[model samples]
Target: MKVIKKMSMTMALIAASATAAFASGQQAEEISYYEPGASIESIVVDAAGKGQVGNWGLGNEYEVQALLTKYGQPTTYLSQAFDMDGFDDDSILLASAMTYNELGLVKNSYDGGYSYGEGVSYIDMNDEGVAMLEDNLFTTAAFAAENPETVKAFIYASMKGWAYACENPEEAAEIVFNYGSSVSPEHQAYMAEQVKKLVETDTMGNMVRDYGKMDEAAMAQTLELAKTYIKLEDSVAASALEAMSLEDVMDASYWEMAMGSSGAFSPEKSEVSIQLKWLPQSQFMGYYVALDKGFYEEVGLSVNIIPGGGDIGETTAVYTGQVDFGVTWVSNLIAANAGGMGLLEVAQVYQRSGLVLVYKTN
Candidate 1:
């Protein structure tokens, strides 16, 4: 698996490669890992083959614009201009690919051509050098300073939640759905399974026992790419973002504290809320499972799980201190950091990018 992954990563950097990403619960069984890069390429090429433009599978207008800039925007880029209704029937030549959920919708769609022989044509953002970390836990530096123990407890509780979810994805899926995930029950389950793969392993296919450790190297790569591809509104903002070092963006002491203490969770008690990136979904199953299973309570936290929506932005809410902690993508954080928001990452949930570029293969 290591050899294959290294080869895949090398090939992808040179040009592009047809890769397939698949996720099913391990369920006491070891499943083969997919090269995230190849899987992404297959999906993108599939969409492009059919004459569609490509972009990130998720993000708002601002983030999407950043994605286009990062990818060397296609001349026909128009994801927001048209919805998914008649994209396949018309000459829509671009579509954002999300490996975890939306891209799955395409493979299951009527008749999209594929690049990986029986698979599809796409490109993984990670491979294309635009891989940004997603679903990271973050908070304002003031909170960390005011309540260092509280920070440690939350990290411990959250890591427990993720570990449990990865090991028991079906149960985790049910928890996410019941927590108000707007997606169908089946879709939630699919997301649960995929997220499990990410939280449990590194991109190289090795098991990662440290559940919430931030990959500093990957984080650095994310920052560099964001600087190149994303343009901040003002030069000052852009300069601030470019000036940030990983130390400014991350404070790992709390995570280390959590790692040092491994006894059964026992806490006096504290209360706080965490805002998620979106409404209830399997992508955030770990936190939900923690809340549902009382892991937060075990760690002495009385957590108020705030669901995210149209008006509820994770980075903004965290920056304003509206929530004690927030779940968000690393790219958004970079944008905010560049714009003078002093948000810091506490825990990294997903080890790999689920975002991909999908296009028509025909």
Candidate 2:
């Protein structure tokens, strides 16, 4: 049986090859490694013939697909995402794991976990330069244009909530747990810790003090990836997707206004609703923190956070005016506007991509 180790920075650098063909603003792929006596070439060779990989559908799956395709390997999707049984049985060669969620289960011995410990290896999208931005705050362009004060107030309060969550992850986890976390208590705590890393770290592994500030370089890389991978059925939408500039999808002015203003604010809209990308968990602790910590109230806003995961997507909900703002990946926001939804991202939440591909070692 083969043993897998968790992706370690300590992995020995044996062989390395890089390409300049990736999106602009993306760092060159510096290194790829496996366990002792293993090379990236060997792993790709094995993966090519095996053709077994696992990922949830949509952007994350696309990220994995892009990476594997770059390696010249066949991408055979798994029936289920995050299937630990398949990972342990070698039925799946690579399984998608988000640092904040599925990775906790993969590493912890708690319920619904494999407890793989140091026996798993992973390929990081950030390192590979295929990373797409995740978890942004966005609304329709009309909403933002019509209600600048409301947008600024929301951003100010939300960034404060994220700051609190990052500083006190354990408490943030508990707070989210109280809000009906879908995962177990232990996993929730693990998620908070991991999410803190994502919020406070940049793709280049630099520590970021400011919360919710969009990194233009990272956004550019994300846009390039979205344009490369995302294909639209609507010909008009496809043309829009191809023609999308950074300005079409995001408005940094709102974030700038929020950051420049004093903590005091009077919102034009006193009450508003925002949608989450998924069910309650530490993945979205910042918003919960804002509500629980009275940051939203401080801004004179009553916020209703609608949980996501139904037929209606977050982008659609915001575009259709079901919510004033929504938390979604940057790619989703771009695709939404390209489809003529006119969504505009107000702030970026997760600074680094949390997606990784986990596999066992020989």
Candidate 3:
């Protein structure tokens, strides 16, 4: 049976070569392998055919699988955008690509960690990307202006998703695993339990139960922190930075909409859906819960979750009507706003950043 399989594969390769020749004037080729003491000419021909050098003996199923995995496709546009190495790593890149694709961008060759330019810092391009994002901020501003209530609902849903993940790590893990199958089931379960412990012990525990609620105080703290890191120039007032206090950013009217009150902000009357850009982790839960539990439907929303990574282009996503909401550090957002992206803070998810740069401690 094994011999038959090998013969069949060889025949298929020959047929493929013949077809290529017929279509594009290429030559037919064959792969050869040798045992110990084989002729040098035999070895050279074999190496050229397989696009490799030296003797690798016979091809196995593993080699075939590797070819399928490696040379299977091309890189995508979003893949080029997030430029994962420029941000963090492959995981972040995959997450970002998934988010943007979900939010309705043209699909391209997207594998997780494709590096484009070497030593191009994400922080340095902040001005260029943010300038583009600033132009797109008008879309978000218009949405906020027209459907303030739905915006609040979207925030409530986001906060609720975070709180749910904290309260039920197992559930969150299941959700994340559904989208990201790369994580082992055992690891997913372990992560869920750990996240639960982290949230329960934190000062924000109470807020998790209340829809991952962010109050004016929390928003104020976030804005203050943004002011510390963001280099805002003369065009945006230092007071504009200060005015970003929780009171200016948070409008609860949207939550009222989800509750079906007369005061609810209705985008249907205006015919619009909010575009939300999600951090890979945040969207994982939101999608699993919203799809599984129907949270989005309950609120009368058609939420479009945009994935981000590589040159993730968060500013571009927001400024171009790709996403109305995005998960970003205050530093990034403040930079975007300063670059004139007009990105406003609707809520703050993480009080302390999970981001850390680690090297060998020793």
TM-score for each predicted model, relative to the true structure? 0.76, 0.87, 0.49
State which candidate, 2 or 3, has the greater lDDT: 2
Better of 2 and 3 by TM-score: 2
TM-score sort, best first: 2, 1, 3
- Alpha carbon RMSD to native, model 1: 12.4
Over 152-180, each residue of candidate 1 has an lDDT whose tens digit, in order, gives: 88999888899999999999999988878
Whole-model lDDT values for every prediction: 0.69, 0.82, 0.40
Residue 13 error for model 1, in Å?
43
Encode model 2's per-residue lDDT on 1-362: one tens digit a residue.
33333232123121112333432212222222246456654665565455666777765566776787777776557754435666665556667789877777887899877887777777788888778889999999999988899999999999999999999999999999998877788888899999999999999999998899999999999998888778789999999999999999888999998999997887889899999999889999999999999999999999998887644499988888878999999988888788898999999999999998777653
Q: Tens-digit lDDT track for model 3 on 1-362?
A: 44765785677667767686543321222212234454333433333344332111111011122222233322111222323332232112111212122111112223332323232111111111111111011134556676576665565555556666766767877877766454355445554554343233323334233332334443444455455434445755565765554434444444434434432334443223333333334334544555456555555666655555445656567667766655544445655555556655554444322211110000
Q: Could you tell me which 10 consecutive residues in candidate 1 have the lowest summed lDDT?
A: 22-31
Clashing pairs in 2: 4-119, 4-120, 4-361, 5-118, 5-119, 5-120, 6-120
Candidate 1's displacement at residue 64, Å, is: 8.6
Which ranges in model 3 have alpha carbons more than 4 Å from their true place?
A: 1-139, 180-208, 232-279, 282-284, 356-362
Which sequence of candidate numbers ranks them by lDDT, best first? 2, 1, 3
